[model samples]
Target: MRRRDVDTAVRHAALTFGAAIALMPLLWMVSASFMAPGEASTLPLRALPRRPTLEHYATLFTRLDLARHFLNSVVVTLAATLGSLLVTSLAGYGFAKLRFRGRDAMFRALALALVVPGQVGMLPLFLLLRELGLVNSYLGAMLPFFGSVYAIFLIRQYALSVPDDLLDAARIDGAGELRIFATIVLPLIKPILVTLAAYTFMAAWNDFLWPLIILSDSAKYTLPVALASLVGEHVQDTELMMAGAVVTVLPALGVFLAIQRHYVRGIMAGSVKG
Candidate 1:
């Protein structure tokens, strides 16, 4: 074979191996979810179940009340994602396009905040939420994610690539800032927004710590928190735990898979344009 062709073959082989290695655990989790009780922990470690069963899943929905937790995850993740996109996009556009006093200073201050560990602020934030009587509420669980500094910075960087002249022309034609943003700016920055949506969705969906801390009500628990509770209750029930894992992972995985193309395109576009 030609040298280039030989090199391409090696690279593809390496990538395939790496991909398989990365996916092995997820594949095993799915396979084990279908396994009968005690089958997953068997001596030989079977990749495929000896006998498939839906009993675990049924138990999760019925006895364990996982459906309620799943619904809570869906509601919180969607709300947080939408709110993040709106707030970040608007703030980013204002920073990138609109000139105002102290704008650069404010942006710099926010950028400095990116270096601070999120956990450092959690205690103070929780106390503030308690003062406002927001603790143990969905709003409290979602408040932290609604407008992150990193997300705002990402949007700002991407927004800088938008043409200033286009916005100026809109202003001359009697278009208000909000109208221009809705009609022109949003569509132009759609790729980045979709990327942000994917990021926010996954973050909110998989979040365990904050939700566990804020939501005192068991009925209001998100999937990860509920799954952790499952671990405590069903520690020896490996198959049951796997089933809950599958349930918790599938929606975020599906959302990412569905939007993966747009997600990649957005990242590349930002890297180049920003």
Candidate 2:
């Protein structure tokens, strides 16, 4: 019993250390955001603000017009999450349930496409968007993500465990495929959908490279792109940058926290079902 207790204590200690190491930067970012303008760069490397102030945040909102970028981020993220859910869920259902010639081969091709780097296609995608007159628009920034191979794969894998008999019964009762999917498959896969939404939201929130390339107008810049621009000019404003970081990170964190219980349950249930 003593030996077992010692082993458990060691494991807990190691896990605690790992958790602290991972979270330390985020904790410090929040702490530094509240510090006075020059206080964050002080000699002693303080973790807590000697005096907290929201001046930087005020500067961000009023002076820098960060709210525009914040609104842009929220709109884009929410749109992407909803759009991804609609597309990935339907595509996943088609893959998991629908029978058709070359279905397995088509899925294999999609899986193969994943090995190709996204950047390889960006040049052509940009040209295509330009032709569509979507350049520098929200649609341009969002176009690439309307379908995601990984998201489809995740949903398809989870959806495969749903009983096909339920679907067949609905079909035998003269129900359309859409009705069966909406009534039966969707409820059984709610947890995974929540998980997918969280992931899609976070990705859309943090995406920088594609948005930077597609959106040239400053007014349309997402939060991450706006933050990057801020850093270029405010290199010396450590506290201000940290404040921007806090604003950029908080929404994604909030989203994950809101869905964390569902995410956990989904993975657990999926594992058992699979």
Candidate 3:
């Protein structure tokens, strides 16, 4: 083979190998979820189940009432994603386009918050939520996501790339600020918003800490917390645990896959705009 062709072949082989390695655990988890109880822990590790069954998944939905927990996760994740997108996008646009006293200073202070560990503020946040009677509520669970500095920063950076002349033209044509934002700015920044939605969805879906801390009611428990309880109660049920793992991972994976093209484009565009 020619040298360039040989190099291309080697690169593709390496990427394929890396992809397989990365996907192995997920593939195995799906495989094991279909295996009967105790089959996953057999003497010889099997890549595929000898006899695939949905009994574990059935148990998760029926006896364990994981359906409730699954619903809780869905509600919390969707609310958090939508709320975060709206708040962050508006704040970002304001920061990028609107002029006000101490605007730069305020943004700098907000940006400084990104350096602080999220764990550091959970105590005070919980206290505030308690005062507001929001503890153990879905709204409380979602409130924290609406104020993300990183999301605001990303949206602001992307919004900065909006043409000043376009905005000026809109103002001259008798368009109000809200009208221009809804009709012009939003369409221009759609890629970044889709990217943010995907990110917020994944983060909120997989989040265990804040929900666990804020929500005390067992009925209100998110999937991760419910899965943790399952681990404690059914440590020996490997197949069942794998089944729960699949449930926990599948939605986030699906959302990412669905929006992957927009996600990539948004990231590239945001990077260039910033």
Q: After superposing candidate 3, which stretches have Cα over 4 Å from the reference?
A: 1-9, 265-274
lDDT string for model 3 (19-130, tens) is: 9999999999999999989999998999899999999999999999999999999999999989899899999999999889999999999988877879898999999999
| Best-matching candidate per lDDT | 3
RMSD of 1: 2.2
lDDT of 1 by residue, 143-175 (tens): 999878877888888889999999999999999
Off by over 4 Å in 2: 1-5, 264-274
Model 1, backbone clash pairs (residues 3+ apart or across chains), number: 0
For model 1, the superposed segments whose C-alpha errors exceed 4 Å read 1-13, 265-274
Clashing pairs in 2: none
Quantify all predictions' global Cα lDDT against the true fold.
0.89, 0.88, 0.91
Ranking of candidates on lDDT, top first: 3, 1, 2
Q: Report the Cα lDDT for candidate 1.
A: 0.89
Candidate 3 clash pair list: none
Tens-digit lDDT string for candidate 2 (147-207): 9887788888888998888888889999999888998889999878988787777778889
Clashes of 3: 0
